[model samples]
Target: MIDNNFKNEKAPRNLGLYIHIPFCRTKCLYCDFCSFVSRDEQQREAYVGALLREIEARGTKDYSVDTVYFGGGTPSLLSAEQIGRILGEIKESFNVSPDAEITLECNPMTVSDGDKYFKELRALGVNRLSLGVQSAVDGELKLIGRRHSFEDAKATFLAARGAGFENISVDLMLGIPSQTLDSLRASANQVIKLAADHISIYSLQLEEGTPLYRMRERYSLADDDTAADMYELVVKMMKDAGYRHYEISNFARGGRESKHNCKYWRLDEYLGLGLAAHSDFGGKRLENTRDMERYLGGEWLEAASDISNSEREFEFLMLGFRTADGISKSEFLARFGVGFDEKYGEKMEKFKKMGYFCEKGDALALTESGFEVSNAILTEILDFDY
Candidate 1:
């Protein structure tokens, strides 16, 4: 059952919608997400049907959706008709803003044609495209088990441009097996020249069950210091290339920041649909079960955990610090009934003196170096329990 608490709330309709597609052509060696390699047409169709039904069952026309993100194993794996129908359902079921930022995450190999699939997706209301171009080197891509080569990624990017996608984001990986500082810099430079509207720089994690983790000694991965240097170099490169480092791992040109992802950093309410998705609504956190059978059978959400004011305060500070704009002191005071400075002023003074923090007007944000050690900084703050 849909939670009544979210429905009863008097807040303005600023909901975001996220649709997860859990099908991929091939699972990457390092991927641990809820995705699988499947060519079962029936299963794909069935999954879409279940997703549409869930949208109808949970969505309200009264809620004004500002953004809709179709993210997944590979959203572009579906036919153009399938994408259009899913988008059509979302529009019919909700008060989606006419100018809503709709994004689709795709793999380079999936949209290489660009003339057909990507163009159709654009016409279907997908204004932004996030292409998974993990590296610029073919060898690194092979090490990471990506299906597409660097040439394929370049071709896909050019195709997206030809297909009329002005807002394009490319993903880049920092640490990979057999990756060196020179190779990392070369990739970063090449991507910068691509002039993608946005870039998401991520580090490779050695998840326990991943193939890379299992055969860890086969490749020479960059050490922690080298990885940190790689990140710093990338940050400098992006900035010099006229992109703003708006978040810890995200850089955008002009005002091309990701609307859907910004909702996550701001703790705004968003509804998640599909297998293994998560939702934050009714003042609680809810995660849908990962079981495909359960999701398709109409058992959608798992359970809800109500958020406390204390938890909210902590998140506000932590998430806000991740952004370039930082936290708003006035907003904090308004939300929590206490001045932010009064609560954590003394604690932050030490860091401020160390040049880790910058205070301009009413906003307090971390410096670039501070972003490097954000976890440690956040942990220390949480430990103090202000």
Candidate 2:
């Protein structure tokens, strides 16, 4: 069952740059990401200036950047000129590859005049757009405190197309309050019809302190079992619609997978810039201070943690399991100086017998059922000490 093609080694020395824009029109009820209400034009301009200074001070020209992602509170909240200025700084400060995949995440409400925004973004070298289209059902969206209507989402997608964004991704939400299997399927179908190159279907999570968590007692949301059913149905439907399930929550058309995100799952190095952004580069994990005022004052405070070999191996296995590609046995041995089966052969046999895993070539991947309980399996199987 061994495959000779899969080798264990770090990929070529390249960089993936992630720029966080912590400004948005409004914070969604479920968002826990570091983004605040849209600031005044003066405040916004000052923030962009600070970001540019940070990029210049910290960005290195040594590594060739192959991917750049502008993620947000709502990156689209920034005018195209502002976004373009940041891109210019990155390009000047780093050895950005010519064909780099530059993506910007946008909320539908911010893109009512998408044609104008999209064209400017394209001119700024951003080739991909990731639209936040949480739900196709209007009622569900309103309950979630989303500002855009379903029709608005459709219009924004069309606008992106008309403005020349051939590589676009759409986000969908499942298991939200009052979200049924039918509604989830309808949303998935709508996105599929949009022919977005990539699709990300995330299950609504009830994190404490969010508005949804406070309102949980009032709304009867889908139970775990119902959510599981919705997950299965969407998986089958997305496959039928010709999208490959590349990652747990992400799907893409052929060759359209997110290159920047793949680096994260593969345990490759990436650098994140901006307030509260995290980075794993040069063998340490670093997190920027979340305080915007402190950041603006030129105090780029950060927390740094060095990763040991054991921690790296643990991450390699855990992250790889989240993708269609299961970890390679030979690669594990090469990297860790221990064979996969030699260390965990019995555990592998046990899970295989339990039908949670399937052996293909040198890789042992989770069955569809296994993905539902991956946390439990990983906890039991991976020895953090080793």
Candidate 3:
């Protein structure tokens, strides 16, 4: 039996639901997502129970959720019945819109079950699948410790299509230890050939705690010069394939951007449930503890994801500037109730002179070169005496 929780509510928000599935088959060397290697039936069932109760507890808010995202250790690991039940819970709890974009992140290794599980997931309301297909080259995939092969990824993509997922996204990685520009290009070209609806290309981030980080002490990663060249190749290839480089790392065909992710990039409020999930209910950012004992037994006060307005402003700038569309002055004003130009005028004056910032109507967007130096640009925005 699950205990009912007192829901926290705030002013109307650009609300979204982020359900974390914290289990994986084998943790990738580069993986740092909050996941544990487990296949315990009891634990899986327990998590679903807690998640359902939490969903029920938050049912009081009369807000619209434009998206629901299942991210994690590999959300595809869960049985379709578990996922379906939670969707039922969400529908029973909140005023979820009929046309909301619901997404599930899946790893290629799991889709070969031949059980027609994805169809069941679609029946339960998951309309999009973000497939983890980091590389097509066997050496790079082996270096990164992915469980699935390139062949498996292709089969999974076909399976997802067979299962009725029209809006599919593939995750691609560059700068792996065993990768060269040509090798990585082969992966990107393969993804394009698959005709995936969306592509998210991420430069490998070597975090200190992962196995890949330890291996990095010995392995020479593809050089920064090479990585830049790889990115350039990807831009050309993906554009030729008819995908729009909407954000720094994301590309989509037509208008198939990840609506759930937009909620995050646009600094909209979201509720994150499950161990190590993060949330920003209006301006107060929170993160659930990574420890299962603390998260499950104690009052789940996830670490703070957002705090003061100063932090919020800096974060907003950091997130908003990552997109080619950039942050809109009007949207910023609508959220903060202050004109962006009024707040960031002199600051923009400098960046404008630097060929980084440009004006489109009342909005400020970044140029292609500006994206390469976006972090430093964020520093310039943050240095403002706000």
Best by lDDT: 1
lDDT of 1 at 266: 83
Off by over 4 Å in 3: 1-13, 112-115, 303-306, 333-339, 384-386
Best by TM-score: 1
Cα-lDDT of candidate 2: 0.86
Better of 2 and 3 by lDDT: 2
Worst 10 residues of 2 by lDDT: 1-10
Residue-level lDDT of model 2, residues 44-121, one tens digit each, is: 888899899999998898788999999988889899999989999998899999999999998887865778889999
Residue 55 local lDDT, model 2: 95
- State residue 244's C-alpha deviation in candidate 1, in Å: 0.4
lDDT by residue (91-198, candidate 3, tens digit) is 889878889899999998865573388888888889999999999987788888897899989998898898799999999998888688888878998999999999
Q: Across residues 251-334, which tens digit of lDDT does each residue of candidate 1 receive?
A: 999799999999888888899988888987758888988989998999988777888778788778888999999988877876
Candidate 3: residue 252 Cα off by (Å): 0.5
**Any idea how many clashes model 2 has?**
0
**Candidate 1 local distance difference test against the native:** 0.88
User: Which rank order by lDDT, best down to worst?
Assistant: 1, 2, 3
Model 1 is weakest, by summed lDDT over 10 consecutive residues, at 1-10
